[model samples]
Target: MTVVYKLNVFKDPEQLNQNVFAAQYAVRGPLAVRAEELRAQLKEKPDSLPFTEIINANIGNPHQMGQIPLTFIRQVLALCQYPALIENAEITQKLFPSDAIARAKELLEETGGIGAYSSSQGVPLVRRDVARFIEERDGFPSDPNHIFLTTGATQAVRMMINLLIARPYHGILLPIPQYPLYTASMALYGGRTVPYYLNEETNWSVSVEELQRAYDAGTAEGTEIRAVVFINPGNPTGSCLNEKAIEDILGFAKRNGVIVIADEVYQANVYDLPFVSFKKVLSRLQTENPNDAWDKVSLISIHSVSKGQLGECGQRGGYMEVTNIPEAAFKQIYKLASIDVCPPVAGQFIVDILVRPPKLGDPSHDLYHKQIKDVHEQLFKQCRQLHSALSSMKYVKCQEPRGAMYLHPRIFFPKKLIETAKAQGAEPDELYCMELLESTGICILPGSGFGQKENEFHIRTTFLAQGEEYLKHYVAGHNKIMEKYE
Candidate 1:
């Protein structure tokens, strides 16, 4: 029996002009969705099944992998969700470290309760706290009015792109081995992505010559480059930036009339060495370009509490600050942001607590520092351990994950394995990774999922395997499978 489907919707006027998101396809990767189905089936199977382990490194949800959340952020969240907790002494103490308590009490006094909605832009106090955090980090005074709180940094990123993309020819400059969020968002928003290559030989750091080459070619191709997105302490590639590279990029932005989009979400995850913030780098560079104020070049930075010590991936708390953006440009941005109503109130409360917390000797201070210190050291240590282990393996080349949790190891694809994978009709990287998954029950993302050099095969796995047990599972599973292919 033949089942036929009609394709007549395209003839309708509403359908012809309607759906832009349908054309965007990368989000629906077979490996990701199929993993979900496989998991459901595996869940019902017994432990004595053929699969040796199930280590999920496919997504970057640290908490899902058994990471503990910071007490301060979640405490306030509980209080926000259920106001009765405000009267509970133990609950109130945990909810706020110290300054948060006073601020929350003040807000309650002024508003009577948090049950009502906040201003369309965001809570003024929370935005002010975000501004203060940025100011102290960069040593430059930031205006609270310019801060726009969002559910997560992703929303802020899309909103900013909407303002920049006025016409079809509009383009954004992104790094080659870039975060999919940027490219995916650009596709959905009807903008072009001009990719610049990072120096893979130099541990995936950006080089001035490379940026110059990309910018020149993009402009020559008649694509109006409105912004350059820099993921400091880069995602997936896990490379930290040096001061010189930061300055070079800033200078390029100033010269090119391109806005700088700094995705500093992993700012606090530096392992062996410290990660520098774009705000700090730009503050110093602005001194060099002394004459230019906001017009020299505009900079917008996106940060998330979902990362760093807060690691509250589910809470979705973050802020985006516009630095040196003109009043007119900001007007357009504010108008669009206002339409979102406001970021989640509970998430806003968490961000407020994160950006501004209690000092030492404050009631919650000891607990806050105690829990945070342990979590930071443990996570950072894990990053170092996995990188060291993977680096020592044969045919696997990996740089130390100085910032983010991901470890991307370049694989040595054997000819036989490549031929087999090709015959299997799967992307070479996908074929290699899937075999590893089924053989070991360990799921990981292929480098091709994120952008990597062509003909290159790599895999990215998180260090967040549920402590030592799964860590041992990861090492044994990967080593065993990879040895067979070799």
Candidate 2:
């Protein structure tokens, strides 16, 4: 007897949500996938590729690039994971610092255990600690009730986009060279993307006029513009927004009646300009003009332990603080979070430690400070080295690294390269990145993935990998490609 075969439930791509297919996350896009295949080949044969090892400059992942985890964070996490370790005070004392033990005990009390789920909103104590962290950072009071611990800022962004983009015509203004998360989320949520190009001449400065122009263009196309996203200490561009810039954006949001979604996950990664929280700037504006529309502006500020010195990306620890959000919308946000149960309990513990770390005179203080300082210095040094290398390259103009882990260098491709890429139906930068990867085993993202001006080319690469040795190889590969294309 012959058996009948049935088609899979979502066999046709059209049968599924088209939005899912529309979403493109270039950070882990095609290039990153191919790099993995190369990595596996290298693991088996050790010399299948031209280079020995893959340099993952594609994403801002510090730990993956050999940055050490904070000893204090790991110690506390160890105790939290196995509370029984804390029971044996004698042995625990020898292995763990007094502060780590105490902190772990406190967190365990709040979370019950890393295995058990906390409140959908998050552990109350952890939320409170996050509130305190914000309060201290912004010099303004924060309400724990308004805080929601998320898997990472990524979740918060998705939630906000889902909530705000209720209609197909709804749109969110995004930086042209944005972190792909915003663009991907927008696409997945069925929202229009209003592109506002960052001013590369002035270190990727946010222009109010550009914002208005994008907003007007989106509006003219029948889009209900609901929110604007800002990535402070920018992702690929490495541009830190000043206080005035934040204020101007808030004012724009207020005038246009759109929400402000501030992604400040790299708040601690600043090297040149001082990082300013949107919450802080908004708070001051409200205070200065109590009767103005400032108080009416709704803002969601997000932070994460994934970036900065911690580099705890895998932990999935982050929090979003909502201000001036309507009570009804707030409840809905909570409802959505509850549907997902709770974020990783272990991640919550990391958030707690991030906001409230070892203070002065604590046993873990000196070591924690030392580790942080070393990471900061190393990151700054790497940024400088890469910027210098790019500056000397022909037809490449790179902005100085201000903050963030990655540098996005503008590459003026040769006319021949452009014509060849067009003939093959590809972006010039995409071809450039692929060539660089094949020759050097160095994986980086093409600017097309992050959105760029027409007729322009760029590559976004993180300087997270240690040592200047890889720099020589990267430069050689880049020069080879540039010469070949020329």
Candidate 3:
């Protein structure tokens, strides 16, 4: 008998794809592509590219979007790239401290070169520097060994999530309007997402009651509630957590017997109140609870160079600090990271720079201070302008950004809006965002893909677009959309 074969193009559309991950990862629709094509086209005719401006609202890349890297950072980073930079008179303009210079030279001498692969965990001296940075940040001692540098916080998150999955039934709990990195990692790893609602009415905070309700519901179903993830100075919604809220969450995790996951990439970017860490809460809770309950809660905090004053998105450097972890779990988590060999060596340098900035009296102090001040001020103003602009929209209700760079406002749209979008064969927010894309060349992430409530709608856009022109254009474009919503 003769057998006949059919091509995949002839198969059922869904059947042609393998793995649920390939589909879940597909959640980010076409914005990235459109942004790239626009840039490529602009590169072809540098002068005639309408308005000398093509804003990339897709990712938070400050440098690519015209936010210059800190002088000290780029100076040191340049040295790392081409060691000849050290001897170059023009480049050595007090960007490195005596200690920092000694440290970098020692690192280069020890490693022979930046091109060499670091230890699976990262360079020892670099990890030690990170631990020091954390200790200073939280006012608690940090162990160097617990630090695992990854390509960025993204890899570290995946590793932490890998350790949490107790099979399909168990889940990781996160705020609904979370960074999609959380959802994407969970879906790709065969884990479930347990979403709790963020109080948009209260500037996207975590209420103790909300935490209890979600945890109780999940555990009541015998769902292996593995971890609770919170983005301090949140991602899409830029509200910083209050002290009581942090204490309540620490207590909640302590009582519920779940891991506490913190994404503190924007830790240094707080505007109003001082930024607090779960480690700070954990330390405080230890004084009262005394049972070491908070310590025993199995915690991992993720940090990135991609946010705050560093905002090194292209560097893609981040570290996950594993604290009070069980020995077996720690080994397993590190082993998962080892499978990737190690994060990029150059990125490891970025982590070192973040953790070990110039202290007082160092050679680079004056310049470092000036550089940090200027860049940080620019970011602060941008956040203010964007927040003010969005708050002016009658149909957009946004919280004032306390930290980070995005505003996620719930947009008022008609009941038939989603249905109308379905008629167009698209997600409602996606349809809304795409119209914004096609008409004005503005790009942003719709809230639906980032895990918003069932009937709610919103969009996330960064404030890094240069000059008044793009932001003014953004605000005006949204006004047109809001008129439709009205």
Candidate 4:
């Protein structure tokens, strides 16, 4: 034939946007892919690998690791999905709790039905509940109009990153050993990242001086620092920020005239430290210094039902509350949300349940509280067990997890292992993690995926993996790797 066909759009990787190509999410990066491959292999050929199972410690997915969903939440969700259950008095009385039935009815009435699209911003009643939740948590007033229900905190973060980044040079400050979503968003949106290192020696505490230094350096290099992100009860490190620390950060944002994006999804995941909201601190500052421009500092605080005791990651329910944002900017944010039409309607319903759970004296109250307490206690126990195991390992310095579902332990690799990693064109920690996965079928992430100080090595593992048996396997595998290198 004489005719030739024209190339299709986006025919190759090079034809696509380079920024998307550059973005990396280490939690599900190469190691995770390999883990999946191994899992498939195990399924097809049972005795092919040395280990029988793959313990996924790479991400904070609780239900995947056997954390049971709260009965009350599931019951309410079921009723919302099928209102006929509520209509059937016999079925409702036997199967669903009174509070769950009532909550579902209220949400169904407010939302019309789960099958229909909600307001682009969110369901009105759900937003109000979220506002009330914030007020109860932070001891400050919250506006329902200012709240936007999202698919998860991830969507809220993406929206804010998109808004803050107008041009290529616009910068956002992120913590090193970050959750990787921050850096990935910056890469996708063509935003510059100004990394401020947390003081690892001090249990991953944020430093005002470090913030100032990074700001000055980024500004000197012609990077316009647009916003600062604070992951309270941080993702990888699991360190909670004190109220004073949060206040200092807000003051910093005020001075720089930049926005504050508080990623407080892990707020309820705190273990040792009391969780304090940036909204709380900022509101207090504004009240105390009425003459100051505290009210002018734009802040977006995010929360999700994914991480806390609910462990509803599959539901993808979350909300972000905007404060001190100008009306024009708020409109723009609303426009962006409108373009997406709406978040999952079912997810929106979960947000409602999360904010307004079974109250005291309700039939579901005792069971709900007990389930939450059990989950909390189990997580705490796992955190202690994992931390202690890693701490005992040679050249491993594990921080006691204060909050969140992860433990980011610094590993001092043997010199020989570092050389081997360099030979393989990999970071030492990455090589260690790879070997660990191959040996024990336990998949974890390396510190290099999250930015780290030069010459420092670390690994991020979630304590969410079930049982103590895997911990023993992890320790043995890690020690064998060290001894091999030595």
Clashing pairs in 2: none
Span of 10 residues, lowest total lDDT, candidate 4: 7-16
Model 2 misplacement above 4 A: 1-5
Instruction: Give a tens-digit lDDT track for model 3, residues 1-486.
Output: 899977766466666434243534322558767656766776887665443545667667788778777766776666777777567646554554455556567678756778888888888888999999888887888899999998888898888787778598879898988888888777777777888988898888889799889988887887788899999989878889977888888878888888899898888888887899887777667766776656787678888888877778777788988888988878888788889888887788878878887778877777777877887788888878877887876677887788887888888776666778889887788877876775567778788877788778888888877666666777777777656755
TM-score of each: 0.90, 0.98, 0.90, 0.98
Clashes of 2: 0
lDDT of 4 by residue, 14-63 (tens): 88899999999998899999999999999999899989999999988999
- RMSD values, in order shown: 3.9, 1.1, 3.5, 1.1
Cα lDDT tens digits, model 1, 347-385, are 777778778876776676878888878878887777777
lDDT of 1 at 451: 75
Q: Which structure is stronger by lDDT: 1 or 4?
A: 4
| Candidate 4 Cα misplacement greater than 4 A, ranges | 1-4
Evaluate residue 73 in candidate 1 and report its C-alpha lDDT on the 0 to 100 scale. 58
